[model samples]
Target: MSRYREFKMPDVGEGLTEAEILKWYVQPGDTVTDGQVVCEVETAKAAVELPIPYDGVVHELRFEEGTTVDVGTSIITVDVAPGSEPEEPAAPVAAAAPVDAPAEEKKPEGRQPVLVGYGVAESSTKRRPRKGTSVPEQPQAAPAGTYSAPPTAAAVQGELNGHAGTVTLDRPLAKPPVRKLAKDLGVDLTTVTPTGPDGIITREDVHAAVAPAPAAVLPEPAAEAPAPVAAGERETRIPVKGVRKAIAAAMVGSAFTAPHVTEFITLDVTRTMKLVEELKADKELAGLRVNPLLLVAKALLVAIKRNPEVNAAWDEANQEIVLKHYVNLGIAAATPRGLIVPNIKDAHDKTLPELAAALGELVSTAREGRTTPAAMQGGTVTITNVGVFGVDTGTPILNPGESAILAVGAIKLQPWVHKGKVKPRQVTTLALSFDHRLVDGELGSKVLADVAAILENPKRLITWA
Candidate 1:
C-alpha cells in the first residue's frame, strides 16, 4: 500500500497570510526527490520557490495556478511508495469538495509534512472555515462520466436571487484574480452568471459583463459615412498584490507613522561625473557597474559615518532611539513589476569596488524579479535615484522602520559660476527626507551637506573617510 503525504503552503514572507501559486514545475505521477523545487509562489514581498522536503511521486495538485492560497493550507500531495501499482485517478467531481474540509479529515493518520524555513506548526494541518459558512458535508463522487461539477457561488446565489424567498448572505465565490478583474471592469460578479467548473466566476465572465450590446438594426448609410472608430479600453486595473501590495502597505505605514522632514540642495558634480568615467576605464573595476549612483552611495555611507546620529531608528514600543552600527543600504530600483528597494548588507563596510559589484548584482537581481525578502529587510537608510527617470528631484518617503531616504535628481549640464567665471557644470539636486522624531534638522543637514560635498569634490570620499 502507498502512503500519501500532503505539502502545505508555508509562510515564505515575514507573517504573510497568503501567496499566489505562480507556477507548478511538477504534476501528478511525476517523480520528485528530497529538496526538489516543486512550484513557485509569489508573496507580498517576493517570488519564492517551494521545495518538497522528501522524495515521492506527485499525487495531486490541491489548487489551480493563479489561486491565492492561505498560508498553512495543503497545496500538493505526494505518494511516498511510488513502486506500488498506480491507483485509479480520483474523479475531478470529487475534487470539487468545498476546500474548507477539516484538516484532520484530509490528512492520513500521523503523517506530518515539513517545509524549509517554516517548520510545522501544530495548526498547520488544520483548515479554517471559509468566510460565511460552517463545515459542509462531503459530496459523494458521481459514477464515471455521469456527474457535473457543483454550481459556482454565483449560480447558487443567482437562483436564490430569482426564486428563493430567503436572502443568502454568503459573499460570491471567485478567485482573487477573477475578483480583481470584476472590480476593474466595474461589474458586479453576483449579477453575472458563471460558466466555470464549480460555478466560479472567471476572467472571461467579467469581460463579457463589461462588453456593451450591439444595436438590433442599423440605419441606411449616407454617402460620406465616417470610418468606424476602433474601440480602446478606457482603463487598466492592476491587482494590488504581491510585491506591489507589500510596497503599498509599507509606504503608507511609513508615511503616516513617521513625521517626515525633507531638505533639498543643488550642487555641482563635475568631479563625480569625471570619476565615473575614470572608474569605468580602471581594469580593477572592469565589468562592474560604474556610475554616479556608486559615488553617491559611497558618499552617503561616509556621511552616515560622520553623522552617526542620523543613522538611527525610533523605537516606538520602548520610546527609545536605537542607533545602528552597521548599514544595510537600500537602493531603490524600478522593475517591470514595480519599484523594489533591494539593499546591500553591511554596505558601510564595503570598499568602492565591492560596493559597485553589490550594486550591479542588486540591479540585475531586482530586474529579474528574483530579489529575496531577506535582501529587502533590515535597511538603515535608502537611496532613490529619480535621476534615471530624467526628473530633477522630489521628496521621497522613508522606508518603514528606517530613519532616512535620499533622492538623487538628474545630473544635467547647467551654467554656473566656477573659477570666478560662469561655465556649464554638472548640476543635480538632492532631497533628503528623514523621520523628524529621530533625525533633527542639524543632524539631517550635516548628513546631506557631507554627501553634497563629496559629490562636488570626489576626492572628499578618500579624505573624509
Candidate 2:
C-alpha cells in the first residue's frame, strides 16, 4: 500500500481567501519532482504558479480547472510510495447519481470536486428509495470506442442532446466559473452552442453569445425579414474575481478611509523638455529611458528631500506620525489585468542612470504580468502619469497606507510670460493629493511648488539636490 499526501492550497497573496485554478500541468499517474510547478492559480491580486513541495506520483486532482477553491483546501493528492500498483479509483457516491443507475457506478465526484461553499456528502453505492414509486434500473453505457457492448438508449439520447450522456446527462457541461459568467451575462447555457472538448461550455462561448451579430442586408422585394427578432444580448457581465476585484476594493478603501486634500499647480517645463532631448543625445544616457516622466520623477524626489515631513505615513493604531527616512518610489502602471503599483525599492539611493534602468524594467515587468506581490508592498509615495493619454490633469487618490500621490498632466506648448514677453513654452499641470491628517495645506503646497520650480528651471535639480 502507498501512503498518500493531500496538498492544500496556500495563501499566495496577502490574506487572500480564494483562488481560481487556471491550469494544471500534471495529471494522475504522472511522476512529479519536488519544486516542480504543478498548477497555476489566479488570486485576487495576480496569477501565481504553485510548485509541489516534494516528489511523488500524482494520485488525483481534487478540483477541475476553472474551479475556485478556498485557501487550505486540498487541491491535489500525491502517492510517495510509487513502486506499488496504482490505487483503484474511488467509487462514485449515490448523491451525484440518480436512483436505478446501473451496477457500474457513475464517475467519481473526486474528479469534479465539490464547490467551495458545499460540503462533501456521504458516499453510498446504493441508491435511496423513493415513496410510492420504484424506477427501473438502467444499465450503464459502455465506455466510448469500446466495441464489447453496443451504446445504450440513454447514451443515444445523450448524443442527441449534444453530450456524451455519461455524467452530464441533460444538464449543460460547464465549470462553476463558466456558469457564473453565463449567469452574469444573462445568457442561457442550454441555448449556447458548446465548442469546448466533450461539449463543455467555455467563457468564449458566453462572450460570443453576448455579442450582437451583424444585421443582414435584404433586397428591396424581400419583405424586410421582420428585423431578425434581435437574438443577441445587449450587455455582457464579467465577474469581479481576480486582479480587478482587488483594485476595486483598494480604491474604495483608500477613498473612504482617508480624507484626501488635493492641490494643483501649472508650470513651464520648457527647460525640462530641453533637458530630456539633451539626455537622449548624451553617450552615457544612451540605451536608457530618458523622458519627461523621468525628469518629473527626479523633480518629485528632490522636492521630498527639501520637505521630508511630507513623506510620512499616519500611524492610526499607534496614534503617532511615522516619518520614513528612505523613499520607495511607486510608479502607477496600467496592465491588461488591472492597475498595479510596483515600486522601485530604495529609489532615493539610486543615481539618474540607475533610476532610468529601474523604471524601464518596472514597466516591462508590469506589462508582461510578471509583477510579484512583494514588488507592490511597502510604498511611501506614488506618481501616476495620466498625460500619456493626452489628459490635462487629474486629482488622483492616495494609494492605501501611503501619504501622497502625484498626477502628471499632458505637457503642451502654451503661451507663457518669460522675461516680460509672452512666448510659446512647454507647460503641464501637476496635482498632489495627500492625507490631510499628516500633510496640511502649507506642506502640500510647498512640495508641489518645489517640483514645479525644478521643471521651470532644469538647473535647479543640481542646486536643490
Candidate 3:
C-alpha cells in the first residue's frame, strides 16, 4: 500500500507565523532525503533555506513560488512509499514555483496543511548583523540535471550520496545576497576569477582573490567645467517587491492615519561618549563594538520604562491603546534595497555588551538586505540614528504600529557649562515624534527628557533605572 505525508512549512524560528516561498530545491516526483535543502523562505528577518524533514518522493506542490503563505501551510506533499500505480512524469523542475496555482487546478484556494508540527495558524497585520559576520562557506560545484553527480549529458540520480551536483553555467550570475556581499567587500563579482565548474564565481573564489587591481585614476582636468548632461538620459525602474512592498504599505498607513508631533532637545553628552570609550577599553567588553549608539539605545529603553505610554499602539479598530511592557527596540537602517528596521526582542533585558552585539548584528544584517520580515514586526518603539550621517536631528516618522520614534543627532564639540562656567563639551540633539492620539504632551516630554537626562549624565541612568 502506498503511504503519503504532507510537508507543511514549519515554524522555522521563534514565533514566526508565516514566510514567503522564495524558491524550491526539489519538485514533484523528485526523491528528497531527510535534511536535504528543499526550499528557500524569506522570513521577516532573513531568507533561510529549509531542509526536508523526511525521506520521500515529492508528490505535489501545495503553493507556488513567491506566495506569502502562513506558517504551517502545506507547501509540499510527499509519498513516503511507492504507490501501486506507476506515477506519471512530472513538470519541469523550476527554481521558483508559481505563486498562485491556476484557476483550473483542482486544489484548495488556500494552501494545504502539512501533517506534522504545529498546524499553520492565521496571523493578523499584513506586511510584512554586521561586523565580523562570517558569510557561510559555499559548497563545491554540482552538475546540472543531477542532484548529486559529476557533469554529464545523461541525468544521474544521487550519484554523490547526498550532494547537489556541480552546476553548469554559461555565464556567472550571482544571487542578490551574494551580489550584496561582493559589493560590501569591495569586490566586483564579474571581475573576480571564477574557479567553480563552467567558470562560475563562488564565494570561495571571491575570498581567495582578496585584493584586486585598483581602478585607474582619471587625470585631473586643467580647468574644471560643469559636467555636461547626456541628451535624453536613460532611466531604470526596478519593480518593488517583498520587503519593499511591505515598507511602502506601512509608510502610507502611518503617514495618512497617525497624527504626528515632534519634539527636540539638545544636551551635552561628553559623559556618555567618555563612557563608550571606557567600555571599549574594558576587558569584559573586549571584542564587542562599543559605540555611542549603545548608550542611546539604553537611554531609550529607560525612557520607555518610565513612560510606558510612549511604548504603546493605538488600536483604531479595537478603540483602545495597547501598552507593551517588553520592548522590541527598532533601529532604522538604510540598505542598498531600501529602509528596514529589525528590532531586538526583549531589548530592555539586555546588558550594555549584549545590546552592543545585537545592534552590531542588526545594522550589518539590514545593510546586507538579509533582514527577514519577522524581525521587522512587533516593534513597540524605535530609534533612528541620524548621527551616522553627520546631521544634528530630524523628526523621524513613527514605525507603523509603534507610538513613538527617537532620533539621535551627531555628537560634536560645542561650548557648554562646566562647574558653572562656559567651556567646550560634546553635545548632541534628540528629536522624538509620537502619535498624539496615544501620547499626550506631558508624557512625550517626559520620555524625551528622560533620554536626554541619561545622555547628559550617564550616572543618572545607573541610579534612577
Quote model 2's TM-score.
0.67
For each candidate, give its TM-score against the true structure: 0.67, 0.67, 0.58
- Candidate 2 lDDT tens digits, 1-465: 234656778766757899889889999999987557788888876677676655678989999998999997899988755665534433332223344456464432222333221121112122334566574444342221111122223333433343222333334555544554566467888899988753567778988999632111111111123333356756645667677788899989999988999999999999999999999998988898889999988999999999999889988899999999999999999876678898988888888999999999888777777776668889999999999999999989898889999999999999999989999999999999999999999999999999999999989989888
Q: What's model 2's overall lDDT?
A: 0.74
Which regions of candidate 1 deviate over 4 angstroms? Answer: 29-31, 81-232
Of candidate 2, the 10-residue stretch with the lowest lDDT total is 214-223
Reference-based TM-score, model 1: 0.67
The number of clashing residue pairs in model 1 is 1
Candidate 3 residue-wise lDDT, 212-286, digit = tens: 221111111122244665799676455555446667877888988999999999999999999988988999888
lDDT of 2 at 27: 97
Candidate 1 C-alpha lDDT tens digits along 1-465: 124667778776757899989889998999988557788788877776677755678889999988999987889888765666544432222112344446543432222223222222211012245567665443333222121233334433433443323323233445533443455457887898877754456667777888732111111112234455568856555567766788899899999999999999999999999989999999999999999999999999999999998889999999999999999999998765578787899999999999999999989777766676667878889999999999999989999989999999999999999999999999999999999998989999999999999999989888989
Q: Answer with 2 or 3, whichever has the higher TM-score.
A: 2
